[model samples]
Structures are given as structure tokens and as C-alpha cells.
Target chain A: MGKVFHEIRDPIHTFIRLDNDEKVVISSRQFQRLRCIHQLALTFLVYPGASHKRFEHSLGVMELAGRVFDVVTHPHHLSPEIRELFSQLDTDEKRSYWKKVLRMAALFHDVGHLPFSHAAEKELLPDEWTHEKITKHHILSDEMQEIWSNMTPPLRAADIAKLAVGPKEAPELEFDDWSTILSEIITSGAFGVDRMDYLLRDSHHIGVAYGRFDHYRLIDTLRILQAPPLDSKGEQSREPTLGVEAGGLQSAEALLLARYFMFSQVYFHPVRRIYDIHLKDFLCAMLQGGKFPTDVEGHLSFTDNEILVELRRACSDNSLSTSELAGRIIKRQHFKRLYERKPTDFQKNEQAALLIKQALEDKYGAENIRFDSPFQKGESIDFPVQLKDGSIESASSLSKTLNEIPVVKTEYVFIKRELEKEASLWLSNNKDDIIMS
Target chain B: MERNNQRTILLGMIKSLKDNKSWCGETHIQKAMYSLKTITNTPIDYDFILYKHGAFSYDLRDELTEMRADGFLSIEINPSPYGPSLAISESGQRLYDKYRENVSQYDPNIDFIATNLGAKGVTELERISTALYVCKKDNIFDIEECASRINELKRHVTIDLARSAASDAYKMLQEYEKHSC
Candidate 1:
């Protein structure tokens, strides 16, 4: 029994405890491969300290997910309405099973991320698949299958996949109520453990304060309350959801505020964004048919280590087709920010970057231009906040700060550094025409 | 779905909901879009998840926000503690007109979705839409079983509410079968 539990010291969560079964998971090759996968991808190129691996981030997520699972499912945390919905919640046996599954799901969630993580993810679709899908596949694969079955009570691969990737990404997978709520604990945009862990962990490693929040209070206050329908105020959906008490409203707002600041100041830093663009260019050129392998075996075979070796090789060898893009990463000759979306430019034309990108590509060849626009998740979270009156209100409506938090949207158009001066002059000359078009 | 097609169809639905419903908020459009795609022969693709409210699509939400940004949609912010409603902008109307033929075949479906769902409050919408979601997920049409399942899934929802919503979903299913494109 003494050997049944083990604890790993984590910077974010302090001590992340795991049982013997979970030890088998981390000891597996798939989980250990995370040691070679950097959490922020190539953000280290800009912030040298931002070199943490997915290994620790995954552990932190497991810790947070476990804590959140315990908090929201605890007897006191369970509202009478929630208990009525799932009588299974009354069972310690069932809660223990789900808690174990949630932790495992949290651990393996990002096992399928590509070497550079999400950089090439969006563009790879139609021809490829998402990291979530890959993670789902990994959880269901033979290697992990064996581990899950060896547990005291065997785990369902489907349950793990559903919780890890959530129903949104795994749209094809059917999620029952039991699975859906647990999945929300990990993937909900507002207060999911995944977002919570990444924000705190990334900020700590990247040496920024933007991602710090009162997580302890936030976690403690979480409950499976009934959320009414949002996007309108007159009616109640009375749906089960994970949220916080009124006391933690400030923490929830801070979490959203931190996300905004992090995106604006760190994740979307122009140099970091440009490095990703260059890395994507290098990857597409380096891979076969300019696509990451979709098959699990093929995807698992490549990590940042292997890709870095090839990147270095391509950097030194001028004869390689990808050498130019590779050198941009290795030698720091990445594209310069030629133009960024300004409020004035947006007021004139919403597709300002789209037009500018097209015109620039036409003038300087498509290969010389790169465009990056990251989607800003709307900050309006509808988690039901329990008020002092014992009434439930959507967080977005109850909190002034949450309602006013800005969505950090960015649109950057980059060009090969050599053409920056000429392009700048040319853009100034014809900018009005482009917006008018 | 084709880009222009999604834009035009969304415009048609937004305009329809605006005209039909007392308030055409983003949630209303999201639920309407789910029905349009799943119940009808609209050539669009969006992955629906049973979110806190009801069946929701993040891709659809993101696109709506993008449409608002790109002048295809406009928002009317309600007073504090209430969310904003959406309407198709002039540019959206122009684009809809330009691609009118693309969505013409699905007009009846869109109209049916808006008119039926528009007047319901968010709670009713949540129950009814989730009923539809259950039918879609499990391929089960038994209203009793669906209601029981919903009550079990969301205890806040009474079995009576679930049954009423399930009946609506079952009828909607029959209507779709009767009016299959």
C-alpha cells in the first residue's frame, strides 16, 4: 500500500500525487516522449526561459483536474439538483472511478501534439488531423490500452478519450452526461484545468505575471451548479455546469484578464508569432508532401528532437529545399512585421489583413509573405456563479470586469526582412486603396 | 460548406430570426444553425457539443464573431446583465443577395428553424435543442426514454420539461422526414 502512491514535485501544483497505475502511464514511451516536446513550441526563441516541456504541463493538468474533480463532486459541492440528475454522484465507488479516469485523461490530453505543437495544426487540416484527434487515438491505442486494462478496475479507453479531447473535438464520439461534465472540468474555455495549468505554468516559466491568478480560491469555489441559458437574460436553461461561488468572482475575472494579458503580451508577441510562422514554413517544406503524417505510428515517430536535428541539418546544407526556412529559425532571420491591424484600418475594412496579404503576395511572391491571425475566444463565460442569496447567475452577467474584458485579437502581416523598408513605403503609398478594395 | 454559402445561409437565418424572434441573440442563432445543419439538407458542417447551455458549436460561435467583425453581422447590446442580439448588416445583405441561390433550396428549413425556435425563452430552447441533440446522438426517437435520459442527465430539468421538449423534437423529426430535401 505504501508503494501504491507516488508524488512528483511540480512548480505549478507543488506536489502532484499519482498511484502505481498512473506511474505505469508516465513510464510508458508515449508519455515520456513528452519530455522532448516543448510546451510553448518555439516561444523559447523569443523568451529563452520559456522552455518547459509538455511533461510537466501534463502533470500539472492532472493535478488540477484531480483537485477540480474532487471539489465539484464533493458532497457539499454537489447541489441537490445535480444529485437528482445523476444519482450515481451519491456513490463513492462511482466518484472514485471517475476521479481516476479524469486524472488519466488529463495526463494524456496533449500526448498527440506535433513537435512544434499547434503552429502547423490549423493549416494541416483537410489533409491532416488535429492534436485532439491524435490524443484520442493515442488514448485508444494498444500501448495505452494495456496500461488502462491493468488498473485495479480497468478503465474505458472511450471515457479517457472523451474527457481528454472533449465532445467538441471528438464530435463523432458520443458523450453521456457523466462523461460530459467531467470533460468540462478539463476543457471548458473559462476555467478548465487545461487553461488554468497552461496560464500559470507558462507565466511562471516565461517569467510573466499575466497568467497568474488566485487559482487556489478559484478551485476551492468551483461547484457543479445549475447554469441558466445565456446570450439572453429572460430565461433559465437550468443546466448543470462547473462554476464558482460569488466570492470567487474576482478570481474568475482575474483568470480571464490574465488570459487577455498573456495573449497580448507573451503568446502573441510579434517575434514569437513570426518564429511560429517560420517554423510552419520549415515543417511544411521538410515533411513529405508538406503534411504531417496522420497515422498514429507516423505521428508518434516524430518529436521536437528529431525535427530539431533535421532543422539543424537543413540549416547547414544550402542544397536542401527547406534550408532557407530552416535558417530563418536557426539563424534568426525570420520575417519582419510589415503591417499590423490597427483600429483605424479595421474601421475602414474588416478584412484589412486579408487584402494586404493578397496584395503583398502578388507583389513579392506568395513564398515571401506570411500572415498570422489568432482567434480570440470570446471572454464571456456563462458558468453559474452562486450569489449570496443562494441564487445562480451567469458569470458574464454578474461580473463587471468579466463583461468588459477585451478579446485579444491580432492580425500580423510579415515579409522577408530584406524587403521591409521597400514594403513599408509601398504599403504607405497604396494602403488606402487596399482598404477601399 | 462553401464559404459564401455559409455566409449567405447564416445571413438568411440571422435575418429570419431577427424578423421572427423578439430577440435574436447569438445563442438563438447557434441553436437555429444546429437544427439547420442536422435536421435539413443544408450543405454545412459544424461539430455540435452538449455545452452548459445546450448544443453549441465553437466554430459557429467563432464564425459569428468573425462575421460581426467583418461587417456581415451587427450587435445590439442589451442593458447590463443582458447579452447582445445580432442582425445582418448591409454588407451581409449584399453578400446574401449575391449568393442567394446557394441558400435558396434551404430557405424553408431556415424559416422553420427560426420561426419555431425564435419565440421560446433560453430555458425552453436549451431543453428542446438538447432533446434534438439526444435524438441525434443516440438515434432514439422514444420521447419517454429521451425524457428519462435528459432528467437523469440534468436533474434541474424536470421530467415533464424533458418530455415536452422530447415531444417537440420527435415532431420536428417527423416534420423533417416529411419535408426531407
Candidate 2:
């Protein structure tokens, strides 16, 4: 009686609906290829239950987008153009289409995500390149376009895909805005759907209680306020703005708390970081040694299994005694969870990095010492929230939870046996040189 | 200083104390004045007599002397009684608290919930029940017991409340995982 739609039961979002275009996209060989992509990459090595794929997460995001659209567009008189999009839905079919588009967006959101997730990208690429850029390329590639051709309003598939990633310069559409939307779909802010979905989803999968929230009330409170541009001595620029009422401030507050709890409770968990670091190191070694084709970098078409295969091969070839280790990790045999400490001051951090680098070089030699600063640029985009006063503010400014929500910077000293015995001594001796948890 | 400039100076002073965690004596004040010029990229006068010193000086002790007499802050002067050695007044603490309070209000619960619940109607006890089934292993709970609780609470609470309570219950069970361990 509520709504009869094609609902794909998901761990994050209970049910993700597939639109006609989304269905086509999802059914496509290229889109389905995302099923092989793990959302958190090598994070599963840290949190074994984090084995969910980008495909599943994308579906979750799509479902979340549909929920956002419902809240943002309804209760207020929607513009005719916006209304036209939803005109056909007398039944769930109409609703299903919206769900599908969002689903497709969510699914492909991380399609360009590298092997072992962000870790691989951090190790391999320069600072300027992003997973989103790769995602855009794959979506526009011939294989995907061929599949996209079958979608309803197929002509817009490319545009939407382009919209999802956005451009560097201030093109017709800013990547800032689209990326903002995408980030909202993924990260937790006042009203980010990604946070919304993951809170419930991660809680469900990880068997934790702290990630639950009032999902529907949040949707109802997504108020849209109108605002004018700052052009003086010209025709009044009228643009309808988005906001959630001050009364909904508590909901926003609750969201920030949940994000903090999740981070403390789940994401930044020490075991997860270690697992990720090992996977990252393994992949980097393989890529650096030219053991695999660089085409993987270009296409990035490898699945979780393919990465594991290469990792296993590398361990064997290097006489690394990591074959059993690789098998356990690939098979979800995970490590014990450890600490999650808030980051220290920025100056202290830089100083710590410098000291750690020096210590590593002193003990393990420059070539052997590898320091991976995972907090590279463009990692966490600020979530923008429309305040009660109708002005858009960055979530960090609005919420205190993010004030010291440490930018994940991991410094790992891969200790071979020769240096293993000295590693503890070096770490103890150089405590002031590095930021300890 | 003009009111705006004075306010800015006061805020900057408070921030310096908060971040640097040190008392701004004469030497610290001189250093601050120099650094402020560098940071602002502006040329400003550094010599000004603080009322407490009853004369112009480059030392922060002079400024603190005048500010204290004006009640801008309350401080315990050194044995020389020239400048404050430590402690901020109620007014300074008020300014510090304002920023601190604003920053401490962040909560991610709403965002987490919204994205996870698809189509946004999963709020009532019945809906919560459905969602519960999806989140949990099929045979983990005694469905009958959960349903009875839902029925009893159906008239008393909103769906959101129901979902929250049920979620908490589930979380408690999961947190105390006996079988998996």
C-alpha cells in the first residue's frame, strides 16, 4: 500500500530503487563492473565486515538521493521544470526512475576508485589526480557509453555522469557544486545523504548500535529557502535556496554526534588503518616493480580479487613470506582493532612527520623507509549546509565534531626482519619525532 | 583603537592565549605586535603607552596594565605590579566560551539516518519492524516478542521514536555479541 517499486535490499540503505536509465546502467557490463569494486578498498583488512562493494554503496547513494529530492522539492511549490521531471509518477514506476538515476550515480560514484580504494590512489597518483576524475573517464568510455545508450533519456547519461564529477575550471557547471552533492551523498554533514545511509548501513553490517538516526524526519526537514545574488545596480537575481529550519538544528546536531561516534567507533579504527597500509604497500610494490601492466593505472579495471592475485604473486616473488598473510587478508581473515586518537596541532603534525622521516631514514635507510601521508589534498571536502538564516555555511564551521576530526594521516614504517628488532627501539627513542596515538 | 579594531585586538589576544597557552607579558606582547604586522601585511605603530605603566612602552605589560584598570580583563599582576602574570576575567572567558560553544554543537545522527533509510517513510513502529528484519540475521530475534513490543508502543510513540528504541535494543544485543565471539 505504501509504494510498489523495484526495491533492492541493501545493507546501508534498506532498499535502493532502480530507475529505467539506472536499471540500464546497472545492468550494463561496465556499470556492473563496479560490483567488483570495494567501496572502502583495503579497509576490509582493517574491518572485516567492511567487505561491501562500491556497487552496493552506489545503490545506497541512489536511494538516498531519491529521499533528498523528495524532501527538497515537496511541501513547497516546485518550479515547473522540476515538477515536469516527476510528472509521470502516478505509481511506483515514476518514483522508481528517480531512485534509479541516484542509484546509477551512487554505483558509478566510486567506479574510478582504485584497487584497495583510496590507498592505491594515494600511493600511485600525483596530488592533482582524483578517483572522481577516473570515474568520469570510465563513464564516458565507449564500453560504458554503449551500455548507457539503452537507458531512458540516454542522451543525458553522459551529461549526468559529467555532472557527477564536474570540471576543474569554472565550466557551465562547477565540480565544486556537483562534488558538493556527491560529497553530501557520501560524507556526514548537516544533511549529507552518504552520512545518512552509512550511519544506518554501517551500523547494520558491523553489528553496532551507534550509527542509527531518524532518517525520515531528516528528509521532511530539508527546507528550501530562496535567496538573491549579490549583484547591485542590476536586475534582481532570484534563486531559490535550500535550508533546514533552526528547529531541525537538533537533528543536525545529532548527525554530527553520530559521525563522531562512527569515526571513534568504526572508520578511523587502528586495525583498519594497518590493514589498509599493508594492502597499499603491497600494491605500490607491485606497481613500482613493473610486475603488472601500467594499463591497470589507466583503466584501473582490476577487481578486489585481481588485486589480491597480484599481491600474492608479489609476496611469493619477493620471498616476503606474505603468501599466507595475503590469503588471510583476501579471504577476510582480519587483524585486531586498535586505537583512534584525535590529531594533534597542525604544526606539531608537520614537525612530527619531519622527525619520523628523519628517524626512519636514520634507522631503515631512505630507500627502505616509506611514509604515506594519507591526508593528501582533496580527501575530505567540506559539507555545505544552508543555515536557518538562508546563508550557506561549511559544515566544519557549523559543527564542532569536525573541528579536530583528524585528517587521516598514516605514517607506516614497513619493518623487514632485519629492522624489526630495531623498530621498537627506534619508535621509543623517536617518540617526540612522530605523533603517537 | 576604534571599537572594531579594539574588538579585533581583544579577540586576537584571547586567541593567542588560547592557542599558545601562555601569559602575554611585555616581551610576548612585543612579539605579538610584530607577528600581527607580518600576518596582516600592514605597517602599524608598535609604541603605545599603557595606562597601567603610565607611559608608552613596546612591552605588553603596559597594555595589560591599562586593560586591567579598564576591566577588559581581570589579572594578578607580578610582584612589580606592572602587568598581569596570569588568569582571564569573566568577560574574556565569555568571549572564549562563545566560539567554543558554537564549535561543540556538531552532531551527525540526522545525516547518518537520512541516507540509510530509502524513500524516507521508515519511521513508524511497523516500518521500524520491517527495517529491523533487513538489518539483522533472519533468525537472530524472536520476531514475536519484537512485534508485541511494537504493538504496545504503537499508540504511544512516533515511528522515529520506535525506530530509535528498536535500534538501541538491537545495538545492545550486538554489542554483547556472545555467539560470534
Candidate 3:
């Protein structure tokens, strides 16, 4: 028989191996299209080395997910309670099937990226539709469904979709306990391999150290242990969840810190964020009806390559209506910072930057300003931690470092480049007044 | 639902859960809200999934966190290893008082959930609620089939316990339907 497994070199994973079934999926047009989608959106504009594609990042996620699956499902890794609860861990065949399904889910997770990935995702998509929704559409498409049907046990498209998007992104799918655990391994708020890979891979490509953490220690210590209840009323009945052993507390802390540093320093950098705004403006003007097509073929028809071509054309030719917007991307004449969020201002008004932006929009004309903020939703990192004596507790109560890590929030208002000096001075003079009023 | 309306329902639910002798943890609110929304068919819409061992809503969890940040809720910290429970602060109480009339319509729905599920721990709540979720979502009314489906969703649960859970859920559904708003 021909070799069933193929290996691809990855900067983060070293060598990512895939089986024949996965090889077929990877070679499909749907998966190949991800190669043209930029992983960090227009982040490369600021950090030039960060021009990596989602293709390799997805492979890295698959590689890491496979490792995590092995570690968490190994006999030694299974606690007696967990083993009793999930007999699938004891059943060799079931475990094998889930592992394969998980790797495939990880590989196909990002196949729905629009041209510039997440840069313009929210504004460009139709109402109630997101990249994750698009991913579900792609996975359920006829061509991909055929590949799933041909798998040894025939993987379900719905199953892959649940794991790929998790419960939050794909609310339509129902996840049982085992599916929830598998999905958590890929998409958990605390230690999902998807975040693990992107942090490592992004750090490696962007030449930054903020996203580095000890994955080896963290992975080995992963356990399906019960978490402590919030009160004494349910003290004895803890909920089983993905957690780490006492030994891995430091590694877990490092991961949280790494994410904070990356969000503050790299991912939410002012320049990088403004570029996303510019890209969104351009796409909104260029795409038909100010919306990208939700249909599979229509969505897959373009990527960053096509966007860049259009961008170059618009930059050279002044006839295009969005020529000015495209120039912001090609010529690096993007928006300049007029106001940044301040804690003091936030004390006066929680929507401090927003208030400032509204005031400035009135002053500078709404067309010359933009507002953007990184994800500020509640993304709690606290999880269960199993002690040496079989006791599980919340990580926040045990680890001081984990308890102290702050949620990263960045809010910015960018003005046209020419108005930066005047706007900055004016805002500096009227900053407090803007926030209070 | 409007933000104030959701908060009023949340604060009232928490207060009722406490009055009903529940621990009033976030899970208590989550499962109760699942019951409130799914069972009562109120206008409050939250996407709940069978997570951990029971129904969980990330949006609800985040809302609680957001409430805590906004001073509408506070974590009543406990001694070591025991997780903290949430309590409405003075500001939250004032807001609840201000919006008392707006949330009065949900009193019966809140009372029904708290009376039924308030005192139960996470494990019991999970099993019973999962059974209820299966019966409602899949429209599986037969006890044996419901038990079998629950087992498929939750393998850690024994067939006997699953059967018991399904029976309890079915009885509760019948009672709720008989007096549903």
C-alpha cells in the first residue's frame, strides 16, 4: 500500500503528519483556498515578517491538537473518576476514531476565511453570519461531505463542525459530554490547542517572544478533572472539566501571561489595529452591496491575493471610487491615533474612547475618523487544577500569577493622517472634558 | 430583551433562587435561566448548550462577569478551595428596585424554576436538566428512549440514573405544561 501518512514541515510544530484521508481533504479546493488568506489580517503591514498564511497555522493547530489528544487520552493521563465517567477513553476503537476526527476538525477550522481573514469579517458578512458559520457551510458542501463519507467510519460533518467552531460559535449544533470535551481541547478558553498554536506560530513568524509558553509541560499536565463548586451547598459535586495538574500551574500561568502580552503588544498594536480599520473601509466600498457573498463558491472566489491586486490597481489608477481607501493599505497612509483609552477617563465614562470618538467625529467630520477596540468580552482564564492528593480547585485561588493576570482591552480612535498633529493637540487639551461630558 | 429587563430578571432570579434555599452560584442562575427561557418560553433569548455536565450559556456567564465589572453584582468570596458565589450589591439592589415593575411579569417563571431547581447541586441539576433538554430539543417524550438518548449524550451516567433523570424531567415537563404561562 502507498504510504498513508504525509509530513509537512512547520516552524512551530517541526513536522506535522497527516493520514491519507486528511491528505485528500488538504488537497481539496476548499482547503487549498486558505493558503491565500492572511492569518493576522493586515498585521504584516506593521510587522513585515508576519506575512504567514492561515494554511500553515491550521496545520500547526492540527499538529498540536493531535499531541493534546494523545496526552489527555493516554491511560496514565486518565484519572480513575474520569476513566469511569468516559468509557470511550478505555475503548481503543472509540478513542482512535475521535482522535482522527479531532485532527481533521482542527485542519478544517479556518477554511472559511474571507479575503483578508478577520480584518473585515464582522462588517463584510451578512447579519448573523460569521466565519465560523461559513466554515460550517464549507464542511457541509458536497465535495467535502464526500471526503467525510469515504472515511473509515464515515466522519459526520456536523461532528467536525461542532469541534471546529465549538459551542459558542456554532450554537445550532448540540454537543454531548464527550463532544464538549473534544471541543474544549480545541477551543477551550483556558488551554485549547487552537490558541496554543496561533500564539506559538504567530510569535515565531512575527519574531516576538510574548506568545511563547511551555507547551510541553502544559500538555503533559492536562487532565480531565472535576472543578470545585462555587459554594458549600454543592461542595462534593464538582463538574469535570479540562484542567492541569498542580505541577503544571506555572506553565498555565505562563500561557495566560503570554496571551496578555501578545494582545497588548502585538495583536492590538495601534498601527496594526488601524490597518484593519482601513482594510474594512476598503472592502466595504469594494465588495458588492457592502457585503461578501455567503454562498460557498462566491465566498471562496477571492482571497488576499485578489484583494492585493485590486489594491494595487486602485493605488495606481485614480478612477476607482475606493482609490483613497486602497491607498491607505498600499501606500501605508493609514489613520493616525487621535485618542487612546485611559483608565482615568474610563473612571469618568466606561465608554471613554467612544465618547471621544463621537465628539471628534462632530469636529473633524464623521468621514475622517474611525473607532476600534480589541475583544473586551468576558474571556475568563480560570480553570480547575488538580492537586497531588486528588483534590481539584480553581486555579485563581491557588496560583497568584493566574489570579493577577488582567484581561487585555485596547480602545483607539484614529484620525486621517493629515489631521493627526492638530487632532492630537486638541484632544490632549480637551481630553478630560470629552470623557466627563 | 432589553439590558435593564435582563438585569431585572437576573437579579430577581438570583434573589428568588436564594429565597428558595439554592446556593445561587452562577450555575444556579445558568440552569434556572435555561429553565426560564426554554421551559417558560419567555422572550429572554440565550444560546445554551449541553456543556460540562449540564446546560451552560457563555453569554450568561459573561453577563455575570460584566455585571460584576459594572458593580451590579459582586463576588461574595469564601474560604480556600471553595469557589465564590455572586450577590447583588447595593447598586444592583437599587436598580432592581427601580425596575421592579418591569420584571414583575416574570415572577411566576422565576418562582417555578427556583422552586424546582434551586436547591439542587450541579450534578443533579446537570442530569435532570440534560434529560429535560433532550426531551424538549429532540421531542423525545418516552422515558426509556429519553434515558437511552441521555446515556448517549452523557456516558458517565449509568442507565439507572439516566432512567430516573428522564422520569423526573418528564414529570416536571408535565407539571410545567399544566401551569405554564
Alpha-carbon local distance difference test for all models? 0.82, 0.47, 0.82
Which sections of candidate 1 miss by over 4 Å? A124-128, A229-235, A378-380, B1-5, B49-51, B67-109, B134-159, B173-181
Where is the poorest 10-residue window by lDDT in model 3 chain A? A230-239
- Superposition error at A134 for model 3 (Å): 2.0
Off by over 4 Å in 3: A1-4, A87-91, A151-154, A234-239, A376-378, A424-437, B3-24, B39-42, B65-77, B87-118, B139-148, B158-181
Best by TM-score: 1
lDDT of 3 by residue, B86-123 (tens): 79987788778878898798899889888998888766
In order, the B-chain TM-scores come to: 0.92, 0.34, 0.93
User: Residues A92-177, candidate 2, lDDT per residue (tens digit)?
Assistant: 66554544444455566666666656665644655555666667766667777776666654443555564455333112232222
User: TM-scores of all models?
Assistant: 0.91, 0.55, 0.88
Model 3 / residue A268 / CA error / Å: 2.0
DockQ: which candidate is best? Answer: 1
Q: Positional deviation of B151 in candidate 1, in angstroms?
A: 5.3
Number of residue pairs clashing in candidate 3, backbone atoms closer than 3 angstroms, sequence gap of 3 or more or interchain: 0
Q: What local lDDT score does residue A345 receive in model 2, on the 0 to 100 scale?
A: 24
